[model samples]
Target: MAATAPKSLGAGEGAGNIGFDRSGIAGESKGLLKVLDTARKVAKSDSSVLITGESGTGKELIARAIHRNSTRRNGPMVIINCGAIPSELLESELFGHEKGAFTGAHRSRTGRFEIADNGSLFLDEIGDMSSDLQVKLLRAIQERKFERVGGTQTIAVDIRVISATNKDLAAAIKEGEFREDLYYRLNVIPIHILPLRERRDDIFPLTDYFQNNLLDRSTDYQIKQFSDQAKQVLTHYEWPGNIRELENMVERISVLVEEVDIQVHDLPECMITPSSHHTSSSVSSVFNNGIGFNEAVDQYQRSLISHALNESGWVKARAAEMLKMNRTTLVEKLKKMHIKPEMETPIF
Candidate 1:
């Protein structure tokens, strides 16, 4: 079963359902909501939409949502990854070849454009499309007509185009890698999605959504809750892989973690440990300060203790367990370092 769509702030509030469906999407962040609002308005028309974002930022999801809520909802929503297919074969894939048009062509095959007649065609990773094909695509978009490869017949399609790309098309045009005219045609209605790091508020909500989906899938699956420290670590770490990465992590935790409560240690080591970039900065700070090695080590120790205490909610026993030290030793260190619960920020 597919995952249920998580609640948004105002999916259809004042709009009154003018072909707006937020199915399979899960986020309440303002950035995401603004994108959805624009999508809701655009779905009513046949305007071409170009979604730009990082690889895992769910550009395809936005495309699908628009298609589902469009006037051609009954028609098929055909998807083609321009980047995944090789340049030599992509032409035939988009505009089907006739029988014996190319090697291994046993019979005539229908292309994505023809199959998506009276519907929507999603061109994923459109930036990776070769310049030679861009000219044909531009003409097809402008006239809604194209001839199949090695065939003289011209087929017309009444299709709405939705294209998505992670690459910078503007830069590609400047570099002469992408056609400027084609870019303008595809980007009539631009929707740029912000990466996950910029929209941190959606992290926990998305995490919960993925966990709930897992619960729905199996009776033996126990929903695991992230500990406060784990959540803190998750929020602090930069998710370079975005939503896709988060979903993968949730699945990994569900399969590997037997306990219902997920601790910070249960997360990937990269999140728990200080990154090399941060460690280099720390070393630079140590040299900048007129402090000895001993003082630097003490400062690092204090930072770890403070982070552990904060993660443990200042409970001495839990904090000590996190640090793998005796409660009394942790208390003595706390007193020696003059550590207090008031220190809210983790120095590291």
Candidate 2:
């Protein structure tokens, strides 16, 4: 466990950082700090924990932190992404399978539960688990014992479970997609990580750290700095993809931009400008002119796209980000609207 979290979101202060230095979780916002505090407090206990957050918020990092700080630190910290494994094969993966358990069961293999005995199990994207598997999982957690597939002997595991999800489990329960009883069992201690936009203060510090380390390790590049304008633009932009997006952008800039200082143009258009959905006086002009509702909406979209292109140095890829749109979707819109060659030089 980290002795203390950095007081500021500067280059290298990690407060209560237990297991995330190698995983790239950098932030000092109140929201992030509070979550770390909660993680620290809960790590001392053996109860199941549920971490909820948007994609790319580093839920797995928190799970590892808990495990590292817990009494089971020396034991194996087994991890399984519930959403990544196929539903048909998930059962065998969780509980060991005996030889001839199924068509492809060539040999008896130990499963995650058995491997995680006397340790911790990190289950990511728990919400995506199918209802059928939910019942078996519930029994395993409640009873702390499960039989291997096609095997009569029961396996007992003394493991701590930490689960993460991007989905709203309550809504899933209300709709009968997830079981209510399972939800209660998994959500013993909850940690909700705020998205990057909500904790915008961490952007610059995270970028600084990611850029320095990413460049220093790269054979093709050297460390680079961000211009003040570039930093401001990044700070103002809403990072829909959160820390993962920011780290990726930093790595891209370090490798792609030759300059020692990263300029505004070096960033992806999405990070330099507000999403097109924000309030804009330029878009309001159509309505001020008393134009038809449909026509006004159409004009607004075109104008926004055009402005995004201009701001993005006529780069369609960056423009699409500035517009908060998929590149293919933007291309289709441009084709339908007849965006002129003079306005946008089409580049595949």
Candidate 3:
């Protein structure tokens, strides 16, 4: 047996160019497209962007996309996870410290903000930052100046800030856990990515991509395909962990499923018979609770519209025709249903 060569992306498929095909973004879902569009547009400026989404939705990847497309693309893009570091040490991590500032501060070291000067600073898990630190961060961001953890001399930085979080900052603010003032400061341009369950169209492409990329990286692993029934299980399953979970699932199957093909039985129990917390169970509950006719009609309409849009590849005009409704009527339905991207997609 021999390893297969990696399949290169077609022309203009890479990120920050024609589309967001780069960085494992792999998908054609409406939500994915809207996310890329927003990120690329904001990348041109030095605005502070706050990205919101469920964990494992690729927030860091989106941040990198923005930094790569920005004017400071050539400069370094420093990233720091606020939640990962302890409160006692996070200050030094962000602002650096001078010698003898703290017990472990043996010598002066540059912090993420200073390192990202004239570049981009990505603050992941901003929601988890301590309130006291948030105040300091706010001051530094507002003044573009900061005194390192131990140093008294102020250092000025010319950098763009991109922050992301899975926690609900609004709710945190109300709960007195997160600062509202800092929230406004960081949220100049807000971008949100829907969960994987809502964008079922992406699951297949992502599966294909993970398998192909994995094969390229691991010669011992042979190329693999998902059976139709397995694919159905994948798309129907509610991906509570979102994109990261899907990627992991593909990697797991590729590594452990000895066969070249993956069948329904190979899928995890979560995908086959989803649990009560899963959306599949929720759908069942919708019927079991004895819903009214009007509520049933609304639910069916939402599902119908979603199916049409997804079937037409989110070409609103085409989806409208498929549903035998005018474009404007479809638009209203989409709005009421909270559908993504108001405008109709242009033909490819």
Give me the candidate number with maximum lDDT.
1
TM-score of each: 0.78, 0.75, 0.77
Candidate 2 lDDT tens digits, 1-348: 211222233322466554433234566777788888888778889999999999988798889878877889899999999999999889899997999999999999899999999999888999999999999999999888999999999889899989999999999999999999999999999999988767776787787667644444445455567665466456545567998998888877766887787776677865544455545532443333344678656655765786677777778899999888999999899899876432321110
> What's the CA RMSD for each of the models?
8.0, 10.2, 12.5
Instruction: State which candidate has the highest TM-score.
Output: 1
Summarize candidate 3's per-residue lDDT along 199-279 as a digit string, tens digits.
777788877777776543555777777765466457556778998888888877776789987876677656654345644
lDDT of 1: 0.82
The Cα RMSD of model 1 versus the native structure comes to 8.0
Q: Against the unseen true structure, what C-alpha lDDT does each candidate score? A: 0.82, 0.77, 0.78
The TM-score measured for candidate 2 stands at 0.75
